[model samples]
Target: MQNDFWQKMWASGVVGFHQPEVNAYLKAHWHKLLTTDHKAMAGEVLVPLSGKSLDMLWLKEQGHDILAVELSLKALEEFIEENHLHRRFSIQDLVHERFCGYELEAMRLFCGDFFHLTREDCQDVVAVYDRAALVALPPEMRADYAKHLLEILPPDTPMLLIALDYDQSLRNGPPFAVSEQEIHTLYGEHYQIEKVQEDKFERKGVETVESTYLLNFREN
Candidate 1:
């Protein structure tokens, strides 16, 4: 999907992919990959390509500061507005619009392009939760995304990445199809990659064929 296509989707309120509830895969599997007897996340989490999902609320309840990066102000607006949140707005260098205290304990939201968020913007992230980031971009931009993420997050940070794969000819995508090889190619330099889960799914509502992958990118 191109920039104009996504910009139009936001402009026209066409975010059908935005789920109202926390992702079940995230709920069930995220902690498994993030925390074990050996190690656990120590500080705030960075959620890239986050579009005001209820996952932020859930994460906050677990005592994690939610640092979310989003592209559309409309998506952020819908997230807070639809939740009937009394959000306080402000402008910061990275935050185009911010919804203060939405989930308690500084759920800082940056409503702008993820690429524009600098390394300084992600200073305290001990964990990176990518429920929706990599596969959201076109094939060419994947490397840049991985590089920027590793540059920002502290080394040895645990990362939970959820990706979708399938034949693109089967459907048009905003949730673009990305394969396991591509995942390794983009992120292998800075992270030890592993495939934690996979599933075949029917996209009955949307015109798409999809399979999901749960990936662990242990920062090297």
Candidate 2:
């Protein structure tokens, strides 16, 4: 998706994609991505294309550090303002021309293009929680998004991914439909994919299927 499209969405306040609460799928199935002993995982959890989702705060409350990236500064600012987080967070330099970083006690938010992030920038990320990123992209961009993730993340990094599937002919999408086969085709070569759950629901009278996946790096 183009940066301007997202900027316009924020500018116009047409952000239906913004969930009012932390996603239920994240709440219900996040434990599956944890270790057997049930301890909180080490390192920061990366949230790509993060758009001021409350899930980051929820993840921090669970004793995980968060590293989130978004393209819109307006959205990030709204996050801090809406959550009353401005008092606790500080602005910082990302050492990049196009990116700005904000840091709280346990979370970092970068306002910039996610694709501009380098592997070194993500060296501390241990896992991923992708509730919105993958499904937001068009088909042509999805491959690039997945490829970029593989390039930047450490080997064997586990991800909790939530995707939506629906008949595209029925509706135009920013929350695009991504099927099971496409998920496999994108990540099957490198990640051990597990279908954790599937739910069917109606959105705007259109039947939608939402899927959750636990993805761990394939063993060498």
Candidate 3:
């Protein structure tokens, strides 16, 4: 999908993939995936395709720096304004427009295509949080999305990934159905993948399964 696809999703308030709170899976497994090393103080965590997720704010409060990237400027603005964080930001244009959180500089949001990100932009990223990003893409884009994650982050970067498995016949999706097998195919070579937990639930009357994985990148 093009950038306008997401821009329109935000503009039209059709962000069903957008969660109102920090994702439950992240909250449950974040400590296990990310360690509290003093070295973590020097690096930031990466959140790709992040659409004004409150989880970024939550992570910032946990004392790690955050680098969140999104396609929609409207979503970014709403995120800051809605959270009453508007007063703390200053902007710069760095390929992607950069929104720097002033008080602690704990949060930095880059607004543009996530695929445009380079290794330098994420060189200090020690961890990743993929609540909505992976499952948000259609099947065709998922491989490239996986590749970009591998290319951008340093080796062995810990990741918490949440994905869905369901009948594609049931729905058309930005929140697409991504099987465990697909997850293995896409990221298995680069990451030591583990299925940590899963839950079965219904949304809009369709049966769905959500799985969470812990991805530890192996030596390249």
Candidates in order have lDDT scores of: 0.68, 0.87, 0.79
Top candidate when judged by lDDT against the true structure? 2
Q: Per-residue alpha-carbon lDDT of model 1 for 29-103, expressed as tens digits?
A: 667656641335446788887886888777776778778877776777677777655554332333233322223
Q: Report the poorest 10 consecutive residues by lDDT, candidate 1.
A: 93-102
Which residue pairs clash within candidate 2? none
Prediction 2 global C-alpha lDDT: 0.87
Task: List residue ranges in candidate 2 displaced over 4 A.
Answer: 36-40, 90-95
| True-vs-predicted CA distance for residue 26, candidate 1, Å | 0.7
* lDDT, candidate 1, at 38: 36
lDDT of each residue in 129-173, candidate 3, tens digit only: 888888889888889998888888876788889988889888878
Native-to-model Cα distance after best TM-score fit, residue 210 in candidate 3, in Å? 0.6
Please, what's the RMSD in Å of model 1? 4.0
In model 3, the clashing pairs are none
User: Per-residue error at 167 for model 1, in Å?
Assistant: 0.8
TM-score of candidate 2 relative to the true fold = 0.94
TM-score on alpha carbons, each prediction? 0.82, 0.94, 0.89
| Model 2 error, position 64 (Å) | 1.5
